[model samples]
Target: MRLLLFMLGRSIKPAVLITVFVSVVSCVMLTFCEKGGYVFDKEYDSVFTSLEADTAYDKVSEMADNTRAQNDDLAKRAGDYIAAHTKPGSTPPVLPDGLAGQAVRAAQKGGDSSSAGQSELYEFMGSSLKDGKESEQLIGDKLSGYKRNARRGVTDEYSLALSAVLTRDYEQVLDNQQLADKLYDTRAANTYLEYIENDMLFFVLIFLICFSSFSSERQSRRLSAFAITKAGAGRFIFCRIISAGLVCGVCAVIYCLLQFCVMCLSGGAGCLDMPLQYLKGYALSSYAMSFGGLCIAAVVLRVLLAEVLCAAMLLLSFLSKRNITAGLICLAPTAVMIGLSKSDNSTAQFVTCKFSFLFGGEGYVRVFSTPYPVVWLYVLICAFAAGALFITLIAQGQRREY
Candidate 1:
C-alpha cells in the first residue's frame, strides 16, 4: 500500500498540475479574443444592419415615449399631489393611507432586474384584455403562419423590430451580431486550437517524462547500473516505458475532461456532441504519440538526445505548420494499414478508431464506408513503433557487455 501510494504521489501530482494548466489556459484563450476577432469582424455586422437598422429604432422610440410619460406621471403624483393639489388648478385623487407603501413595494418587486419577467407581464396583459375565442384563433393563425414562414425560409420582421425594443440601443444590433459571430465561430476556432493542444498533450507529457525520468537517471548513472543488473535492462526499460506512457495517458484523459468541461460551460450542451470524427482522430493521434514517444526514447538510448529530439520534433511541428510530424506521431500508419488491405463493403470495414488521447478523426459515414486512408497510416506507425521496441529489446538482450 505504501509503495503504491508512493508511486501515485510521484505520478498523479504532475499530471494534475499539467491538466489544470491546460484547462485554465484554454479557458482564458476561449473567453478572450485571440488572433483578434478577425473572422467575426468581417461578415455579421452587415447581416445585423439589414435585419435591424430601420424598424427597430422607431418602435423602441415609441415605447420609450410611452414609458417615460408613465414614469413622469407617477413622479408628479408622488411629488405634487399632496402639497400643491389642495390649492392649485385641480385636486389630485387621494390615495388610502397604506396604498402608497403597497404601490412602492409592488414597483420594487415588479420591475426587478429581469427584463424578461417584465415583458412576460406585458404579454399577459395583452392576452388577458382580448376575447378568449379571438385570442385562441389568433394563436392558431400565428402558429400556422410560423409554419408557413419556416417552410418558406422567411423570418418575421416584427420580431426583429421587437428585438430592437428589447435591446434599446441601436448599436446593440451590431454588437449582438458581433457577439453571436464571436461566440459561434471564434469560439469554435479556439476549440479547434484546444483540440490540437489536447491532442498534443501526449507529446508534451512525453517531453516532460523523458526530461525528468531519463535525464535524471542518465545524470546519476542509474541507466548504466541497471544495464548490468540481472534481468534489469528489460524490466527497467519496460517498467519505465509503461509508467511514462500510462502517466501520459492519464494526464491526457484529465486534460480532455477539463477541456470538455470548459467547452460545455462556455458553449452550452450544443458543443457536447460536435464532430465525433475529429474527436476519434484526436484520440488516435494522442495515444500513438504517447506510445511512439516511449519507443523513440527507448531506441535512442541517450536520455539527452531523446529529450532534444522530442523537443525539436515538437518545435518543428509548431513552426512548420505542415501535417507531416503530426501525421507521423498521430497513428497515420494505422489508417494506411486499414486501407491497403482488401475488405468487403461489410461491417469489418466500418471500424471507428477508438483512441483516448486525441479527438476522433474528422470523417463521417453511414456504415459500409472505410475510414480515411490517413487513419490506417497512423495505425501502421504505431505498429512500426511496437516492432521497433521489440527489436530494441532483442538487441539489448543480445549484448553481452553492459
Candidate 2:
C-alpha cells in the first residue's frame, strides 16, 4: 500500500504544479478580458468623422434611422425565407442577397467569403434560420402550455425568463441586425455559456497534456521496473490509472473553477436564473434553460470527459508502442467532437457509446431542460471509462515483459 501510494504521489506532483500555472494564466487572461467582448484590438478603427461638421449629427441620425428601416425590411425577408424553406424534407433556406444581404453581412463581419466553400456568414444564417426559430417557438409554446396548466406565479423560472424575453418584439431584434445576431437568437442563460465558449480551447489543451502523460514512463522503459515491484503488475497498473484519473479529475475541477472565476470577474457570472441558449450568430430567443441545469451538466461533463480521455490514452499507450501512433489514436475524436459541438442533429445524449467523446457539447449546453438524461449519459460514459481501464489493467497484467 505504501508503494502504491508513493507511485501515485510521484506521478501527480508535476500535474498539480502544471494545473496551478495554467489556472493562474487563465485567471490573468480573464482579469484583463472584457465581458462578452473581444480580448484583442484586431478590429480597431482609427478613422473618425469630425464632429465639427455642421450636418454631422443630422447625417448620423439619418443614417441610424435608415439603418433601422433597412433592418425592418431585412426581418421581413428573413421571415419569408424561413416560411418558404422550412417545409417537410425541404432544403434549408438560403436568403438571397436582395433579402437578408445586410444581416448576413453583419454576422460575417470577421469572416472571409473568398477563402472557403461556405463562408461563416452562410453557416451562421443557415443555423439561425434552422434552429433559431424552432428554439424560439419551442420555448414560447412550452411557456404558454405551462401557463395554462399551472396556478398563477407558480410557473417555472425558465418559463418566466423565456416568456419575458419573448414578450419583447423578436422581429424588432432581427430587424436591427446586430453584428452577433444575439439580439433575437439566444436564451438569456445561454449568454454565460456563449461568453465562455472560447474557454473550451483550454479543455483541448488539457486533453493534449494528458495524452502524453501515460506514454511518458512507457517510452522511458521505466514502467517495467515499476510493474515488478512488491505490489505486483495488477496493482501497478491500477495505481497508474488511479494516479492519472486523480490528475485529470483535479485538473478538470481547477479548469472549471478558473473559468467561472474568469466569468465572474468579467461581469458575466450572474446568469443562473437565465435560460440556456442555442447559437445562431449569438444567443437565441425563448429556448430558455435553467442556469442550475446547465452548470451541473457542464461541470459533470468536463470531469467525466477528462477522466475518460486519461484512461483512453493509457490504453492506447499500451496497445501501440509508438508514441505518435498512440497519440493520434487518442486524438482521433477531436475533429468529430468539434463538428458535433456545432451541430444540432447529434443523436440522443443518452445514447453514449464508444465515441462518447465525440458526443455533443449541447448535451450539457442545453441541459437546463434535459438535466436527467444528460446526467445519466455522463454517468454511463464514466462507467464505460472505468470498464475500459479495468480491461487495460488485465491486459497489461498478462504481459510478463514490457
Off by over 4 Å in 1: 1-9, 33-190, 193-205, 227-231, 274-373, 386-402
Q: Candidate 2: deviation at residue 34, Å?
A: 4.7
Would you estimate the TM-scores of all the predictions?
A: 0.37, 0.53
Encode model 1's per-residue lDDT on 201-248: one tens digit a residue: 334444443334444454456656877877555555445544544454
Cα RMSD (angstroms) for every candidate in the order listed: 19.9, 13.6
Off by over 4 Å in 2: 20-140, 143-192, 195-200, 273-293, 322-325, 334-344, 348-374
Question: Please, what are the lDDT tens digits per residue for candidate 2 over residues 179-234?
Answer: 22322222222334543443444546455656665466677766677777766666
Q: After superposition, how far is residue 399 of candidate 2 from its true place, in Å?
A: 3.9
| Displacement of the residue 191 alpha carbon in candidate 2, Å | 5.0
* Candidate 2 local lDDT, residue 55: 34
lDDT of each: 0.39, 0.51
* Local lDDT at 34 for model 1: 35
What is candidate 1's local distance difference test score? 0.39
Question: 246, model 2: CA deviation in Å?
Answer: 1.2
